[model samples]
Target: EFLRNELEDSTPVIIMSTAGNESNVLNAFEMGAGDFVSKPVSPSELLVRVGKLLRQRAN
Candidate 1:
């Protein structure tokens, strides 16, 4: 996968698909994604996920 090769370390990626499809999310994960967000996403949800990922990286 490109991400697996491109990313130097554990990088977090947030994906927004048209619908809440598991395939896209799974593929991202398989490609070394730290997180995946499906579409119809809320602002609050995005904020939370971003915050969580940042916090996780900080720790």
Candidate 2:
């Protein structure tokens, strides 16, 4: 999060973690995360998320 703030760049950050608590997910977004996925992540889902964010970024 500190790095995200410091970099001042538009690159997306997607957090994948085993901790699926609502607070953690919300906090990540509050800190500028583009997306979050609880673990045992699916490759297909991850790809979809990346595609979505990328499409938004393109705009």
Candidate 3:
């Protein structure tokens, strides 16, 4: 799988999906995604999540 192959590269992925469709977010988490955001997404929330993920990566 792409994720497995890229895991060693320390790649981060963000997945977005409707509230009712949680599978995509779950899959992304299973694939080692750094974060997941659900829609209808708010600009402030999106910025916060992205900022958190970036800060995580920096540490």
| Candidates sorted by TM-score, best first | 2, 1, 3
For each candidate, what TM-score against the reference? 0.76, 0.91, 0.71
Tens digit of per-residue lDDT, candidate 1, span 1-59: 56668666666777777765777778877877777877788999999999998999899
Task: Pick the TM-score winner.
Answer: 2
Candidate 3 stretches with Cα past 4 Å from truth are 1-8, 19-22
lDDT of 1 at 4: 62
How far residue 14's Cα lies from its native spot in candidate 3, in Å, is 1.2
lDDT value, residue 45 of candidate 3 = 92
- Pairing residues by index, what is the TM-score of model 2? 0.91
lDDT leader: 2
Residue pairs with backbone overlap in model 2: none
Measured on C-alpha atoms, candidate 1 has an lDDT of 0.79
Question: What TM-score does candidate 3 reach?
Answer: 0.71
lDDT of 3 by residue, 1-59 (tens): 37656556665567777753667667777877778777788999988888888888899
lDDT of 2 by residue, 1-59 (tens): 77577887778889899997999999999888999999998899999999999999999
> If both were scored by lDDT, which would come out higher, candidate 2 or candidate 3?
2
lDDT of each: 0.79, 0.90, 0.74
